[model samples]
Target: MSQHRKIYLASKSPRRRELLRQVGIDFEVLLLRDAPPRGPEVTEIVLPGELPEAYVARVTQEKAQAAWDAVLARRLFTLPVLAADTTVVIAQEILGKPANRDEAISMLSKLAGNTHQVLTSIAIKYQHQLLQCTQKSEVTFAPLSDSQIAAYCDSAEPYDKAGGYGIQGMAARFISHINGSYSGIMGLPLYETTDLLARLDPH
Candidate 1:
C-alpha cells in the first residue's frame, strides 16, 4: 500500500496503470526489449477447443514469465513482475479488438442486448515463486441503436481494447449491469492484486 515497495508492471494499458496508481501501489512500466511481439499476440490465434478462462490464464502467465526473463536479460535488478490479460466472450466466441470499423460495429451489435463474460487473469512473479489468478465478470449490455454504435466506433475507442469497448469510457452508457468486480472489468482486480503482492512482497 506504499510506494516504498514498488514492482514492475508488464503492460502498456493506461487503465491498468491508473488502477495500480489509485491503490497506492508504486510501479514502473516494463517493456520488452526491442518491442518484441507479445507471445500470445504473435500467434493472434487461440488454440483449438481452448476455453476463455484457459486462454486468459495462459496469456497472463506467458506475459509474466516473459517479463521475469526480460528483467534478468536486461539486468534490471530483483523486482517482482506483474502482468495481466483480459478478454471478452459472448456465446462461446472470443471477441477480439476490431481491425476495422466494420468489425467494431459487428462486435458492438452482438454485445448489445446481451450478457457477455469479461475475464481478466493476473500473474505475479517474484524470484522463483509465481502466483496467478483469474476474475470473471458478466456484463449485460443495453440494447443499442445503429446510430449509437456508429457514434461510439467513430470515437475510435474500440480499436485497441478487447471486446471492442472500454467499460470506463463512453461504453459505460451501453452497460446495463455487471455482476463482478468493476476493477477487474476495467483491467485489474485490486483485491486479488493486493493480496498477491502481500503474499509475495516485491522487495
Candidate 2:
C-alpha cells in the first residue's frame, strides 16, 4: 500500500484543524453533507442505554466511514480518512453542543464546581483496515457563578463546541484542571492521533 503524506479530515471544526497542525500533520478538510435528519450526515443521537465511550467511538467510526464513501462516490484521490468526536459527560449523562444560549448556560451550570469526563474518540480508515481509539479526560471546573456562565455564553465559542465550552478559549477560566490529553479535551487527542498516523503510513 502506498503511504499517505496527507489525510482527509472528516470534520468542520477549526479546533480539530488547529490541533492537527500543531502536531505537524498535513490533512485536507473533507466536507460531508451534515444537514441534520435530511442529509446523509452521521447522527450523533445517543442510542438507548449506550455508554458514553461506545457512543463516541461509534460516531467517530461513522464519520470516517462517511468520508471514505464520499471519496469513492466523488472520485476524489483516495487517502486515509481521519475522524474524531468529543462529548462532555457529567453524572453519567452525555452533554452535546448546546442549541441555544439558554441551553449553553444550563449545561455550564450543571458542570460548575464539578469534575466531568471528556470523551474523545478518533478513527482512521485506510483501505479495508480501520483503526480506532478513545481518550477519556477528566476536567474540573472552579465553581462558576450565574453571571460568569451568562457572560461566557454571550460569546461565540460555546455554540459549536461540545459540552457548551471550549477549553482553549475563555472557558479556560472555568476549568480548574484537566487530567489527560489537553488536545483530547479540546476535541482531538494529539498523541493518539499521531500514533495512528504512524501506523497508517508505511515509511
Query: Largest lDDT belongs to which candidate?
Result: 2
How does candidate 2 fare on TM-score? 0.95
Q: All candidates' lDDT scores?
A: 0.89, 0.91
Model 1 quality (TM-score): 0.92
Report how far off residue 186 is in candidate 2 (Å). 0.8
Off by over 4 Å in 1: 1-4, 33-44, 201-203
TM-score of each: 0.92, 0.95
Residue-wise C-alpha lDDT for candidate 1, range 1-203, written one tens digit per residue: 34337899999899999999899898999975433453332234688999989999988888898899889988897688999989999998998789999999999999999999999999998888899999999999999999999999999799989999999999999999999999999999999999888787434
lDDT of candidate 2 over 117-170, digit per residue (tens): 999999999878788999999999999889999999999989998899999999
